[model samples]
Target: MQRTKVKELLAGAEEGKEVLLKGWVRTKRGNKYVTFIAVNDGSTIHNLQVVAEADKFSEEALKDVTTGAAVAITGELVASQGKGQAFEVQATRIEVLGKADPETYPLQKKAHSLEFLREIAHLRFRTNTFGAVFRVRNTLAFAVHKFFNEKGFVYMHTPIVTASDAEGAGEMFRVTTLDPINPPRNEDGSVNYAEDFFGKATNLTVSGQLEGELAAMAFSDIYTFGPTFRAENSNTTRHLAEFWMIEPEMAFYDLQMNADLAEEFIKYIIRYALENNRDDIAFLGQRLEEEDKSKPQQDRQEMSLLEKLEFVVNNDFERVTYTEAIEILVNSNHYKKKKFQYEVSWGVDLQSEHERYLVEKHFKKPVIVTDYPKDIKAFYMRLNDDGKTVAAMDILAPGIGEIVGGSQREERLEILVERMKGVGIHEEDLWWYLDTRRFGGCPHAGFGLGFERMVQFVTGMGNIRDVIPFPRTPQNAEF
Candidate 1:
């Protein structure tokens, strides 16, 4: 009487049991003796085959059973005599819930490019590729909360709009309710934010690390997982205007502790995905392998997607100082042959190419590069005793590169104020944040992992845009 999910039926539903199955038709084919309809309800990657005998159902009753059409069937579960699936259904009654015209349907039984799919994001979820991608994304997201909960960390929901720019990059989407054409103005003819909402300038937060730190001061261990926005105009495959971030701030955690937790956290989630979504991962891996066939042998990935994930989980990430990383890069044959697109120097921030070289070529595994120069890093990172570098670290993954960026926070009030002033961040803007140090400050550390990047890494999706649904980029925001 009740509908059964395709996943449950396929898992091990009792044979000969009468069941009601509801799902969209993936494909329908028959030789006039019987109709075999492959149906999927998004429960699992595989489809449940519904066999409708020609004698039992007239031609008119099955005429609308096309791809993308929704259907309901009352059938008897039976051991499948087919090659691929273990079990299928023998339909006794059929109902076409909805019909999709085969001629007009954008998605048919054929390959569609990722670019084309982006244009029709609203319908892309119906595709097997996207279905698998989102399912893996779901598993990884749940794993994040589980990992933190098991570690006794409080999940903190930080503000999305704030007056302070955590990264201090000066690229933020302004949040204000004021006339853009002509409205409030200062004596200097500049736009006056004092007359705007919040009574001061505010923007979509670029990172929750600052607010996360405030919560961590009280809770001792907290993490924020939410949407973060950036106003960067870049249209790269890796850059998105709006994305999700996972930031975990911990009290009394030094740089080493931060790195250790990050390493453990990454491996835990990857292992979780592998354990729970093996079929999906395998599908993506095969998809990637097929895609890689078009590229030159040299440019193709050395390892398959599954192999890369397993390698990261089984192996320990190589740890090196920023200076040591630079040394390794400068002396390497890739650097000598001028293969690197960016220069490798002591103070210069390492680019994606350099990070990938360290992880993919030199180390052949994940690497934690630490103690970067203060000039290139944010003001909040703890200054090293040498006064040249900060207690910062970045976890570089093989293909993705720089999956996690974090550092030990500067708990000393005087030093923090000085660093803020040097970066032109007025103390007035974040006095509440400074209060933690003014009262009872201790050494603390945290890191931020871009959620989409993590999904991209796990799914082996080359473009960051493909991993996230409804990606907001330079000039694209289509659903």
Candidate 2:
């Protein structure tokens, strides 16, 4: 018989029809009169209730039906007598496909701490929280592609290994095939990359935006969605050593257009989650509320999950300049009372605390802070007429600070080379990148949205690691 997923079964499959169900058991209750089995196929957050008569199956078959065990049940779908469920399967035949050793199985019906779940990452997918998280994640990812495809943006596959540091942040994972203990050396005794693979120093890409720009030049509009690496040693809940980024570059666009696209893209994905994954999102919202209850009252959020998503889609993002944002923070009561950890300055890079204050406290909405100091932004960002600041923009959300960063690139060849030199980057190292400006380069703009951070924002997941299936951190590479 063909099998039916838990999701379909719970959606009220025709009653009095024989249906086959295959899935792992979530929970099992037994008495002399009857046995109740909760089965889940990872199709939905809800488990399908399966009822079996005491004498329906053999003792050995019934004994193996435990939590984490895989089972197949052939039964007749009927209206559930249970309160919460609408339909259930009345099992006429039961078979144990695989059994989880009851004594050895790690997962139980009870909730597991998020930290403990990380250790058992391999098994975490079987849990409800993770199941819901990944399901929502899948939908959000699909929504990203759908949103861009409908807008005529060509998806570009950029190289994963590169010699150029796009961010010039000096925090990139080196990619090499040299002997670590004893390797090639130069006349000066430094490690010589001349003899190594790639014929020069190379590292995992920090961002595809650079190559993405090359594609945009040809395709007119392009976007990249791929994994990016950073060697920064930050072990906070907000940081991940390896993550994914979505960058879209468009020719003939300005900083304002870039900010508008980011805002529209984010809201599109959030709205998708709100529409497609209602049950899973609802479960996550309740989970977040429960988690927040343990925090201090002052740390509690102002809006609920559904409400936050709706607010972003329905309202316009507040746009301001870095100078204006600085004034707001500097004049705030927190700064006046000396409660701000990082001092507010016109040219200083805004920290997480400052960004959160602007989004969660001051603006109470998503805000796009633009025109940051040229010194603090990437060299490619176009220099404004004032010459002190670049035409850059950063979108900050209420809970997640700086969700998107982009800029109107410097299309002027001479100015770009001068800025690169001022930042100590040799022009010879980026010949092709310079060629773009040397050729028929036009005014263009783009921005990068960290994929994992976006996932954390939509899921209400506190830690960045929880959103991705396998999280690589400073010292922890365990699966």
Candidate 3:
């Protein structure tokens, strides 16, 4: 007989019916007559209970089978009498598939620090917290596909290696075929990269927006969801060397419409994960309660992820221009108590602290800060009528400072070419981008959302490194 999922077995199956199960022993307790064991098959965090009489299976047989040991069993399904579970199994045959050394296994009955878990990433998925997180991660990815697919968006795969540095921060991980120790030297004493692989020079893509714009021109609506690399050395909770980003490029769309789509997309993902994995969310909530009684009441809110998402999806996003946001921050009563490091001014870029205050304290909801000063935004953003601000918008949530960054592209060929010059970007470097505007261009807009940041925000995870499997950070790249 085929093995049943642990979760399915727990839902009160046929009593006295033969069943086969395979899993790792999570916990075990026994008396003289029989032994009770909890087995989990990696399908879900919840485990199935198995009862075996002393005569049926030797007590010494599994005495050494501690936690994390893999096993299989043939048993009779029966309704559980325990308060913790609704159903269980009565084992007639047992098989030890894999043995885990009790001394070597990192996981124990007690809780382990998140730092400790990071070191053992390969085995972290077996832990309940990580299992729940990755499950939600998988569902969120599917949700992205579902949302874009239904809206007539073409999924495009942009090049992983490119010549353009999208962020213009000069933090690219250089990819070269030549040796660095004694590399080819140009007559000017600089590195000669005429013979480099991919020729000239190349690096891993920081963002797909540039190429994505080319796709949007052809497909009208296109989105690229893939891994993006950054070589920034900052060791913040938010920064990572390698992370996934979602760039949605839309032709004939303005900044406002782009912001609206981003809001809706975020809500849709949270809703999908909640609806599909309600049990896991509930389990986490309960587990958290048992672990930390002093956690904030809002954290314990029984509002299902779907319900919270519904509230966001059905309602209009609170929108405020950058100028208005600065005014609120400058005049808000709460500002009196705290000393802000960076001054909030008309032309200043909003820091994470200010962003947090705006979303968490002022609006108490997701807010879109739009029309930022041109000096602070990217060169591609469309210049607004004010002659100082760009048609850009950033979606800020309560805890996550900026979840999405987007702007309306400069469509006028002359204006775009001029803006490129103003930003000190060479006309030759962005010739193709300029050609797009010269030949066929419509007012386009899009956003780049850090996928790990989104996961961290939705799951209330503190660190970006925790969300991505095998995270690559400065001085911290271990498989």
Clashing pairs in 2: none
Model 1 lDDT per residue over 190-296, tens place: 88998998889999999999999999999999999999999999988888999999999999999999999999999999999999999999999999999999999
Clash total of candidate 2: 0
Clashes per prediction? 0, 0, 0
Model 3: per-residue lDDT, tens digit, 276-361? 87777666656544644566765553444434445666667789999999999999775666667778788999999899889777
Over all chains combined, what TM-score does candidate 1 have?
0.99
Q: How accurate is candidate 3 locally (lDDT)?
A: 0.84
Each model's lDDT = 0.94, 0.92, 0.84
Q: What digit string (tens of lDDT, one per residue) describes model 2 on residues 437-468?
A: 98999999999999888888888998999999
Top of the candidates by lDDT: 1
Tell me the deviation in Å of residue 344 in model 2: 0.8
- Model 2 spans > 4 angstroms off: none
**True lDDT of residue 236, candidate 2:** 92
